[model samples]
Target: MNFDTNLILSIMPELARAFGVTMLTWVAGVIGAALLGFLVAVARRYGSRWLGYPLRLCVEVIRGTPFLIQLFLLYYGGPFIGLSLEPIPAGLLGLTVYGAAYFSEIFRAGFEAVPPGHVEAAECVGLNRRQIIQRILIPEMTMLVLPASVNMAIILLKETAVLSIITVPELTLVISAIGSQQYAFVESLFLLALFYWGLVELAGRLGRYMEARFSKYRFVTA
Candidate 1:
């Protein structure tokens, strides 16, 4: 098989353009995950068993099912429910829901890992539940949450591949379309592999830096 150098060069420009879209998906996915997961965790904590059970069930159901199915549900399944989501919206929604489930667990553990003394001290200082949660709990929980959040961000980055199925035009879809259109099969996929690897490497280094930074502010490294 003759490797077409010209084809690779042509595809590189398109891949580079699509790389921005890929990063957008990652950023949106993480934002969605963080907010959704935080809400779920809060609901579990404050909403008590009534609201908590359903949230837990939601997390379990999402985690149990494959993301491909969820993407289909958002992209293909929503129309039946009178929700017309575009491809990117569908993909974003699906990844958000999926990432939320994992992130909820991360958050729950993080909140739990908050030292009891912190909570008690906040109470003694006349902090109400809301105030204590906002100030004491969140700050204390960060020490625990930072590492897991770092992991979740990396996981979400990898999971962006699933968005391709919904035709979100993310990195995977971009490469797949290019490969099929141009038949620069090996080069296109190889470039994608390289792109994803580079992202993973960068994320690992950033995570280490974050760990060091956050660890400094952690209270007794509990």
Candidate 2:
């Protein structure tokens, strides 16, 4: 069978629109996950046993289960518990929660990688906890975490494709629908793969650039 270049061209506009949704979802998810993950890491590291244990359990639970199941529970099962949400919001929440679990581990590892003497030295210099975290710990952790965080971001980006299962109108859903209606699965799937490949490639390049820019700080000690 002839490859349908025309069919691919015809769906470019729809693909572009869906691509925007995917990007928006991914960007928001990454930001939310990073911030929440940092907080979780900090709380688990410094909070009392009561708080740390629960947070640890939650993190383990989230990491152990599949994201698809978690998303289903949030979107489909939530209505039973009076937590109904639209598809997009549900997708965003699921993405954030799922990504946060992994990000927290990455952040925790980064924290551990920082020398304890650095924190002690900062404290000895009369820096309070917050100031120490902001000025010293964060800068040091950023260097350690950048590569792992970037890898997690890419994983979260790919996970957005699963959002279509909940009818989130992301790239996968739109392309699959087009393929079904037009009987052009080959063309549709090819375009979908191309878009994702391009996105992942761009993300990889950006990550490498950021890593190079930050390499000088990686070896800097307190």
Candidate 3:
């Protein structure tokens, strides 16, 4: 069978539109997850056991489940509970909740990586706990976490494919739809892979840039 370059070009507009949906959901996911995960991390660090234990449990549960099931549960289960959501919002929420679980762990790891000596030194300088965390630990931890956080973003972008199962009309959804129409499964799938390849490449480059700039502030002792 001959490959049709024209077919790929012909579907560019359609695919790009779908890709817009994918990128939008990705943006929603990253921002929502980062904020939510930040809260969860803070609670885990400073809240009472009652709050921290449940937050930990939530992280574990979300991490244990697949994103597809989470998407189905949100999209299909929302209507039954008297809350309705559009496909795009459902996709965004699902990816955000899913990403938040892992992000919490990633962030918590960064906090734990901060040395006890720094905290002690800050206290010796008359800084309170909040000051130690805010001024000393967080700034350095941000740099240490930058590389992992960037990698998480790449994973999140790729995982946007699962939203296709819920008919969210993302990149994979459009490719699948065109594949069904033209019976060009291989070609359509190839284009889909190319689209994802571009996203991941962009993410990787961003990660490298962040790592280079942020590494300057990383804590190191002689």
RMSD of each candidate relative to the true structure: 1.5, 1.2, 1.3
lDDT of 2 by residue, 21-72 (tens): 9999999999999999999999998889999999999999999999999999
lDDT of 2 at 127: 98
Q: Measured by TM-score, how close is model 2 to the native structure?
A: 0.97
TM-score of each: 0.94, 0.97, 0.95
Residue 191 of model 1, lDDT score:
78
Higher-ranked by lDDT: 1 or 2: 2
- Please tell me which model should have the higher lDDT, number 1 or number 3: 3
| lDDT tens digits, residue span 165-215, model 1 | 877777899888888887778877787898999998898899889889778
**Candidate 3 lDDT trough over 10 residues, lowest sum:** 213-222
Q: In model 2, what is the error at residue 218, expressed in angstroms?
A: 2.0
Task: Return the TM-score for candidate 3, rounded to 2 decimals.
Answer: 0.95
Quantify how close model 2 is to the true structure by its C-alpha RMSD in Å: 1.2
Cα lDDT over the full model 2: 0.93
Q: Which number leads on lDDT? A: 2
**Highest TM-score against the true fold, candidate:** 2
lDDT of 1 at 49: 89
Give lDDT for model 1. Answer: 0.85
